[model samples]
Target: MLSLTKVCAGYGGFQALFEVSVEVEAGEAVAVIGPNGAGKTTLLRVISKLIGATSGEIRMQGASLARVPAHEVVSRGIAHVPENRRLFPRLTVEENLRMGAFPRAARKRYAERLEFVYGLFPRLEER
Candidate 1:
């Protein structure tokens, strides 16, 4: 469902990823394992369009995502949860989850998605 071909990305002059390639099929789970500063997060950021790829290509079902904007990425069915978990501290759990589904496409299925989440984590519903 997703493929990266020799993708390269970085912040300014500091290179974080160099020709990294990966492919994930439908219903398949893949893990990106590396030590500190291995560009794992950078790879994700590039895939989600949080940052641009310096070289190579990222394709979602053969559609190029190189020029896609960050906000539009979720609407394309790619969800990214950064390592820091940037949640609002003052917001309730439900509020935080609602914020996650802020994209128009996700919001359309808000009720169904919220119910699914509540079912998965009963404690979240209580919170």
Candidate 2:
């Protein structure tokens, strides 16, 4: 589970998020919906440690992530896919999927995960 408390983040002096708080329970799906420049992406970036929180705190499974680095976020069981898919257009579908499984934990179960995903969307395998 992930929790954000009174998170305030911004670029320079322009505040994008102010006292924003959110919680995501295990096995639950949450969506961030808003208009352009609504700080949705900023919220995610802060959560993923791609950006830092100016105030408040973030916790995962009750552990504080105040000083966790961006590269270590995935190892902490947090994976972030930006709004931009950022897929390698020159690569094949399988290649792209493989590219996504770069984390050590995911790499160990690459085949299994690939099969599970392909089962969910057969078109991926066909592509």
Candidate 3:
């Protein structure tokens, strides 16, 4: 589970979130809805560490993520997909997926995970 309390994040002089709080319990589903530029993506970015919370605390399973970096966020079991498809134009589709699976500690299970991904995209399996 992940929890965010009064998260305040923004750039330079502009602000996005204002004392925003959120919670995602394990095996639970949640959805965020808002108008254009309502900090929807920013909320995700903050939790994933892609963007820092100007003020607030983010916790997962009782551990604090105040100092965690962006790339390591995924290793903590949190995956972040930006608003746009962040694909590497120079990399093949397969290579792109590989990049998505970057946790070195997960290498031994890569084959099974690859199969699971392929199951979701049969065309990828064909490739």
On lDDT, who's better, 1 or 2?
2
Residue 47, model 1, lDDT? 87
List ranges where model 2 is wrong by over 4 Å: 85-87
Question: Where does model 1 exceed 4 Å of error?
Answer: 79-87
Model 2: pairs clashing at backbone N, Cα or C within 3 Å: none
Give the CA lDDT, 0 to 100, for residue 93 in model 2: 89
Q: Write the per-residue lDDT of candidate 3 for residues 1-37, one digit (tens) a residue.
A: 8999999999888899999988889979899999999
Error of 2 at 110 (Å): 1.8
Quantify how close model 2 is to the true structure by its C-alpha RMSD in Å: 1.8
For residues 1-127, write the lDDT of model 1, one tens digit per residue: 8999999899999999989889999989898899989998898889889889999989998899877888777888886776466546788988878876777878889999899989989999888
lDDT of 3: 0.84
lDDT of each: 0.87, 0.89, 0.84
Best-to-worst order by lDDT is 2, 1, 3
Question: Residue 26: error of model 1 in Å?
Answer: 3.2
Candidates, ranked, TM-score: 2, 1, 3
Cα deviation of 92, candidate 3, in Å: 2.7
lDDT of 2 by residue, 1-127 (tens): 8999999999999999999988899989898999999999899899989889999999999999998998898887776776477646688989978876877888999999899999999999999
